[model samples]
Target chain A: MNFSHIDLLSFKSSPSPQKPLTLAPWRKLLYIKQEYPDNYVDESFLENLQKNVNFQSFDYFALCRESTVITEHISSVLIFVAVFIQLYHDHLDPHLLVSLGSAFVFLGCIIWEWCLARPAPPMHKSFLKTAAVFFLTLLGLSPILRTLTQGISSDSIWAMSVCLFITNILFFDYSSDLTYSIQFPGSVALNAAVFACVLLASRLSTNLHAFGFMSFALEWFALFPIFRRYLKRIMPTGHLIQTLLLVAITFVLFWPISRAIAVLYMIAVFSLTFICPIWLIFIQRYKNEIHGPWDEARPKVHRFRSPQR
Target chain B: MPALNICLASDFFYPNTGGVEAHLYSLSQCLLRRGHKVIIITHAYGKRTGVRYLSDGLKVYYIPGLVIYNQATLPTVFGNFPIFRYIFIREQIQVIHGHGSLSPFCHEAILHARTMGLKACFTDHSLFGFADTGSIITNKMLKFTLSDIDHVICVSHTSKENTVLRAALNPLNVSAIPNAIVGSLLKPDPTAADPEWITIVVACRLVYRKGIDLLVAIIPRICHQYPRVKFIIGGDGPRRIDLEQMRESYVLQDRVELLGAVQAADIHKLLVRGNIFLNTSLTEAFCIGIVEAACCGLLVVTTKVGGVPEVLPEHIIKFAAPEEDDLVRAVSLAIETVHVRDQRPELDPFVLHETVKRMYSWMDVAVRTERVYYSIMKVEAPPLIERLRRYYGCGQWAGKLFCILAAIDFLLYLFLEWAFPRQNIEIAPRFDHKRYVEKAVWRH
Candidate 1:
């Protein structure tokens, strides 16, 4: 779907009076001392605002609009539960699953290196090597992390894990491009996830279980996000397929539980995904985001420094 | 009309150096001069905790709290309610005026003040964009805080417009009040007899938003054309490298002086040393520095962005588009205009005095703010219809949600007072009432 048109459509709906906006007494410029003795808004204002309300329905149709968000969240939760079920049933050895995930991650990194090596200059190769070494060091330190939280109580661990998960959700930088310089939000979430895994690993009875958890952590925290971003960028259709497959797998795994609970969860998630878009569309009827000259002017950076210092 | 006791609440206050912090201090002092008691409630900074007194008997209470990024205190929404109530009762504060949008402390204070049935006024000192995630979240939070504010104050007409749009508030409820600098502090130097070199002084934090990049990009081209022109850049930030690179790129070592950061006291002296005050900031709520430069009798060459154009009259300023080429052209025009001028540049103190007086005065702000207080108190309770009207305008779902929040807040206030009756709570006396001079003359 082309997003450019939607933006244009939204912009065109602005209250365009015949006179030039600049010369008007109510020019949005913040500097002048204009007296608005009476109320700025009225029934007429709301009536004017209503012109753009119906546009929301077309922009945010149920089933189509919110399905992407719901699918991703649901799939991630299902994948986690599936991994735990496989561990409990011993259908797949934890160590083997851990090793497979680690190998896949390493292979993904190699692919990334190969891809970068084509377009990037030789100088950038050194930076990529440094990044590789950094990841290697992190992998080397994983075992130490597994044992670091031995002294903490189980109750504390449970509370800490919950806090970490919430942090991951709250601070997750949803921007697919990762164009921001800081990326503090994504980094914080990754850090919290790493901390949670380390604390959880310490409770494991065997070194194998600890290593399995650490490897799984690397797959989930580091590589999965990269894969997700790549898929989102390239084959977004595959994401839908993956989401559906995960849902089917979760339903099959949780068949032993009362069918009602599974059905209830499905109904709730489906309603949320479908109903939210409608709600959002309804709400958009009143989304009169007032833009005036007083709002801060965004600085456009004309000069971009070459990668070379 | 009697002088009212007013409390100015903000996360940023004295000892903090910025346009907003300075404005708060000077305005509070001016309000004090009007015989109105001004008290400030801000988060604790350094060792400046508990009750402290500044010049002119202006009282400040730096309540202890964890200072977050850029000195904005951690926002524990309902935590400060009890202490705030105590302070309000003790000080006999008729008005609660909050400052700065980033200050969640002030927002919380305003909410609590409204909940306590006190008149609450808010002053937004910075501009924000509607785009970007940070701004979207900030705007939402601002709307939540501003939903029930009695009146809103902005430093400039631009700021007022921005605030009204950003918070979805009624424009009539908001007032455009420009910031003022001490005209005496920034007086033009009469003693120095330097050559008529077109010295351009750029004094601002060398940050991306300040348009330091624009200045850095244009300075070299400007220098090559006009050899008599010299540049003095002040303030330091992450963008120092860009400026340094530009300096080296242009090989303008002797022509440009980079005084990494200059003290506030030296700003006036430095400003007066230059013929042109160059501001290339992309965004400014109300530029105090440019006003100070104007006050110092410097010919202004500034980007006509944000509140810069509104700050100075067209005759006094040479305005430029916020582009490198335009700024250079503007500077050239200003230099040419100065060279061809027959009379000495008008450094009329009266112009500034009138401009500043017309826009805002601390006493005027205090009086305006005081009216909100009495309006809230005079009524037994806010009518549901009025509440619904205000809330309904916020947004569709948000309007209904806000109406619910307002109702909950109103009920919570009654429940709190009833549960812990005010009669049982003893009010503390004034900490200190030291007599001071320089009371502002009340015009009314």
Candidate 2:
């Protein structure tokens, strides 16, 4: 809103007993005891005010494209759950799932080594070293993990998994910036996904099922997010294709279980990617940022360079 | 004009010293001097509870209430209405003047006063931005409270604009009445300044908003530039360590003195000791610090943020953007001015003090505030239905909510009147200012 209306409204509201020209011109200074009434506002009122100083206007297509990160994250999460459901029903072999996940991780590492804008830093522990240690630890923990939730009902297990997954999706860092270090909320999201994986692992029948499922869950939850963020930055087209592939996989896998669920999933993915961005852009006109002298000044500290010459 | 019974409501008053507290006390005194009955209403500060009298027979009602934070009373919309109504009826207060926009007690008082059909005028002590959760909430509350206000007073023109925008008030109702300091208290000491050292006094709570960060950034560069210059930093807060660290790292301990947590009474002495008073506030409504410093005959170097520019004349004060390099440059210019002034024999602290005294006197503020009081009294009080309509226009959701609150406040007002019954409450005897002064004060 133009603040000039305030000057006019305030002037119009008052009972102007004398002509404004009859008095000395109004100055903004408080030091001067002017002849005019205290409330008498002139043209100079709110002259220094500036609105929408740092506002960013968004485009509909750009917003829709940007929203793909959310759709991609949701789709990938649903695909993992579908795979979990397949393993739960004994439709997918645990050994085959583990081998496929390992092969994918190996290919992702090759791409990470070659295609990164800033090449993946020299690994503190090489992927193989950490994977071996983790594999050995999981091998020992499999028997204990399989029997962990045997006493609990399956309904409660399903409910708890859904809750943990929701928590993960809500806190997940969707930003694709490599410079953005993991904050506490992002860490919470990562941990929630891992915890959900461990919970679902308890429901599996055999030790190999638990171990193999747990390994795929780790590969999907932990490492995949980092990879997806990199995919968007390094290869935007590949990222879009990857998102479409995840949605299709979720749909195809869920269709065998229930056709209604597959159709619902497709609609959710479509609206999240398409309709939500349009709604966001629709509300962008409501953005009103008022900036003037009242804002806290960001101190510009200049670095003192000592004279060496 | 007949003497008006004015109740000044704010959570800030004596026992907790600050700008708002000082404004209340002195403004009350000046109002009393003008033959108006001025009483301050504030929350209790420790054992200083109940009604107490200060100099000039200005009565302060220390209304006991829970202080939520920074001495602001908990915003119970209708909780304080009973006692407020009882006080209003008993004292026969015709005008309710509230101070400090941040003070919830003041806001509540204004709300209840409108319910009681008394003319309410609010004075905004600070400027607020339209960002941040705290500001957004405060601005909304201000809007609800000031929607039906009789008049509004801001401490500066910049502050007036801020209030008009924040509360959506008509500019004609919101006047720019700058806060005034007690001139007799801040007598400049010509002998206090050191001849050899160019002492620059820095006084404020060492917080980020006060631009203590800028002070920390610029001090070393300023010291490095001038060999004879030194700093006397006063007041303490969370950012005090940064200032200490800056001093220690630069190893200019001898050049810089950190006088931690200086009281209000000692600010004049601190200002007098330096040739320049340096203020680096990020946002100020109308900084009385620069006024007090200018009164002490010190060259004022302040950032050109908020109303700092409007407070002092250009010759006495130098303004800079709230940046490290600009502030350092401003200080350099102030140091140069001080040096040039040192060569002349025409430097007189009394003349500077007199100029400030003329520019800002509590009597002038009181007279202007009196004019506001008189003007508001002329305004017809809006009925409850009309008032609800005013609140309904405050916002979409908040407007409806404000209307509900106002309706409930009216109901509370009805309950208080029936419960306490104004007839049962004995009217407090009005203090005869003239008779008391002539008999007790002059007789001694």
Candidate 3:
């Protein structure tokens, strides 16, 4: 018999009370054999089969709203690529890019402080102190990094950087929980981005160019995600605006390099942000997560006083 | 009816002591008593290898394999097929019964059994959730393994539900047969004259999933609520340190006793010392430990999780939500009830023992299990195309993948048959058959 077609709800045992059917009181389980056959699926067999009971329905708009985080993350990666390409081509000066990036980072910190609803600290001193220490470390490491992959071919270096950058974007933590100070996606993602930055920086001629790029990469990859998380938490509208502004800036920067590529990137961004959510909603009808009394219970424990009390 | 040769496959057995191991041994013994030839096939432990016979002439084949975490053999698909085939041919096995979901050996055995066109039965002993990544992968594997199996058995109704969802098996094919205790071993101690202090016993592996954290959190509160209460914990794991730390920080050294890992034989003795048996497990399929404790006349107070609530009648058990405060409240109530009952002397240990004996026994489980076997044997093996059709409903890509896997397994079986002809292998001598005697059923 084809067992898959056996509908648990429909397969009732023959109710004919023949041969003095020992009708025992209905219990969930019993060792003593009842008159029913071994395969007799009673009415209560699938009574607890709860279908999609714990399933949370998704609203199209809310889902689209949530996809904004993915869009923002992709936009940031694209903007960083655009900036790196311009710097590599010598279309943008290293000193000017570093100064502008630092200024934006400072502005971002102030907005982040406001979002956190905290009185701003003496920003210039702490910011400069952190920047000084970061730049000093980068300066010391720039020479080593410049020659780290000196023997490798430029094509291999470029290919490896692309893969690492893709890894960075794929593993980025986009979960809404921002309570953790360390952030999700943890060290593996950060290491991938930093390795990609080091690889890209090695292509530059001078140590200072590599140093500037590395510092900016730190601010972009490490600090920017924390800032984005705070912005999303504090002002959702500002978060959307930030995503849009980043996308526009990336498009404008890349338009000069290749118009077709810039147009394709924008289309990809829009499709990922809008079309994906619609696709998710369309597929939500197929979501059939079956949960019942069988699943392991998550323990809920609160603090208890010491026995000495 | 002619008796059939059955091979019980699992990673757990005699050398290793666990609930599944005991269940397998007892079930095999009972099946043997009922005139069916049964042999166990498990991974070789430390030095024990090749075929060995346990007491009552039950044969065990300890196949040499790489033992990984928790003594489960590393899942090398098709690695054990040649030896398994040889064993099947040598034993002239008709049915292959696999136990324990976590046992990759059992899963592989079931897969190979179906490839060889033998009737395969699986017994799931634990509950699993669908949320976690590990569970997702395991569930998919279970679905693949069970796609073509003839029958599935679960230790509890909750477990039956879980296995059905995990493997997508027909509910009719999956029987809810619970693990049973040897009722004779758990006779209650009647010599303890004074019941002034209410001792609560907890004997389980102190793992996170076993709710050791909840146990640690509630111990202090429960002890403080009732001054006469004392805790005796058994079994040890990585979380035992946390429990010890809790005891130290709470200064409960005198009141709470930690008897690190006790033998299975000593559990009944421990339960008899305590008036209440506490189970703080986050999940359980069919808690044989709780049943054994109940058989020893200890009032059971357990979290209402998994198959625990259905294991015992409500009157003997006090249910608590799987939370620290709720467990404390439940244990406190049980302590009060036990204390009052002790004063009245109305609580009969013999009655509790009788109730537990009636509820669960190895012979009963074996009888039910044998019935499942009979039912499955009545039906002939479905055509390969029909089996493939069933597997094709698993998922889109997974269905195709499973079909490929099933086809490959079939080809491998053909290759093994060609390489080592079944007639070339020597058949193992069977045990002398005993005449079956019907024991009178004890009814309440």
Candidate 4:
């Protein structure tokens, strides 16, 4: 029955009519004696070889929606770069940056509550303790952090910053929605972003600027993905709105300094959200993932109760 | 037919014991009985280096090398050429037969054998997949290794299909040859099992692939349904702890007996004591364990996975999906069959032993294998250019790389020929079966 897929092979090598008719038909069983040669390719050969039995074709809309996650992530990273650029030019006040970061953090917390998703179980007592400790630590380390990479050439700092951001994007976990805390891959991405921010923070003229930038990095890199994944899972519409809001904010942030870059960024985001998903759907027809009896069996273990005695 | 001087090469052999090792030993023994000069070439195991003679004059050459993961030597693709060339020339090996797809040593041997202009045969012992990085690499390597081999052999028909797909081989060139089960070790003892209660035996490596999770699930349920039945779980692995935990959770200390990592020789003894044998392999190419259990007169209850249903008759074995409930149902069916079969002399353990012996014997495998060998022997080994042409068809990128590797192997062969010419290398004396049988060892 499994050999039904081997139609081409069986058609070509169907038992030769020239042979003695007394020979019994070839059977798949090994226990029985057969009169064919060892390498005899029976007409039924490979009938069992299945191709893409578990194939699931993707829908254009769903694919496009999935593509938004990438778009959203890219927008957030670009927004952080725009914010950093604004800070480096001293056009933006450090206190204003910190206030803006605090307002966004408060909004993220409000959204977490609005979803009535898994109650942030660890949020109650430790949230204030964590904020206090984080504030004190940054205050203590600001001078050292501000001067850490000051001696390094600007060329090296920029190159390293680019490398780390690429690493972050490559390793970031975008699918999983179970953990409030990010998984290992996501953690690697967060660490890369944090290190990149630290390298950029060293170029700041003062401790207050370094601390404000570091705080923004924490909110964006460390916590935003977990919140984004959660929002996408429980409320897809809200996730889409958040993505658009971030893209708009990034566009506005970059528009002040470079209108050309800001417009280009919008075009990239629009295509990433709209066109790539169509391309993905178009390419879905070419997907030929072969699955057969040869694939490793995935064990389904649970509190399985046998219905029979 | 003329006797062929065959060289069976694989990373897995004699010193390291498993399915492939046992297959190599038994098949070589049968080939030796047929008057073929068979020799085994594997990497050194511990201090077991150089040449050693197995029973029936089946010579083994353990070429000393660095042992790495899973007893397989380090994969230095062209590094093995010199020694393999030396062995091939000295032994006058007409056909190079490599076993096991996972063994880089075997793959390396096949590549170099073709480079030296020798007919090569490969026997795949396990089923593999197209997914996963490890399997992808393995499939690509197999495609390269099998690009121009004379013939290929698989342990089962499903395995044949799998190998053909994995390596893109012609269906006419690949043969289905099942591994032979030694008859002497599996003689059944009907009376050894107690009439008071049925004892179910599961003899497999307690690994996830062997479906230990299914065993863990069905054991308690089966015990609840059949109060008198006991279980004997043989073999050990990382999943052993899971089984132990299951037994503890169900408080089945009295009913379940864990015979951890039973020696291969003792497994048959364990099989004889059980009225039913349960196999829960998730994906199996060929299950020799079930046949052995049936030979010992145990009614077989196993998952209907890759090549398993083709192994035994419907009356002797019951099939189940890899799921828990179905496995439990199969066990129940098997238990009932065993109960009814107690009265019939035809289904007796002794009778089953004779039936299995007739159905699957090493002699049968050897005869079929000999036929394959003889067929391949007449074909001329292709020149390096023709060989490179075959490798180039493997893939756009991989083909060129394979061609380069084949050319390098050709250069290495020339260097070895110049460094250690055939005239300089002493040809080892052929094993005389007649003289060996006449003479007896008396070191004492």
The candidate scoring highest on DockQ is 2
* Per-residue lDDT of model 4, residues A1-309, tens digit only: 011212222222235657757778889988987766667778888776677777777877887889888888888888889889989999889999888888887787776665554645544645657877887798789889888888999999999999999888888887777546778888899999989998999998889999999988998887778788777777899998998899899999999889999999999987887898788778878877777777777766666443332
**For candidate 3, lDDT tens digit of each residue in B225-293?**
778888999898999999999889888998899999888778777788888899998888888888898
What is the lDDT, from 0 to 100, of the residue B28 in candidate 3? 92
Can you give the DockQ of every candidate in the order shown? 0.16, 0.45, 0.38, 0.41
Positional deviation of A174 in candidate 2, in angstroms? Answer: 1.4
TM-score winner between 1 and 3, please give it. 3
Q: What lDDT tens digits, residue by residue, belong to model 2 across residues B206-264?
A: 88889887888888888889999999999988999998878788888999999998888
Docking class of 1: incorrect
- Candidate 1 lDDT over residue span B1-444, tens digit each: 576788999988878778878878888877676567889999899998999888767789999989878899887776777788778877888788899989988988887787776777788888887867988878877998887667677776666666776787766566555576676566676344146577888999888888877877788778878989888898888998888888787778888889988877778778878777899888887787777776766778887776677676777678888887778789999888767654533534345334544443455544444444444344343355665566667777877776776677677667777787777767655534433232334422
Descending-TM-score candidate ranking = 4, 2, 3, 1
Tens digits of lDDT, candidate 1, A179-262: 212267778988887787788777766566666666677667665775555555555677667666666766776665447756
Better of 2 and 3 by lDDT: 2
**Backbone collisions counted per model:** 8, 0, 0, 5
Reproduced native contacts, each prediction: 0.33, 0.62, 0.51, 0.56
Pairs that collide in candidate 2 are none
Question: Which portions of model 4 show Cα errors greater than 4 Å?
Answer: A1-19, A114-126, A303-309, B194-196, B440-444
Score residue B118 of candidate 2 by CA lDDT: 96
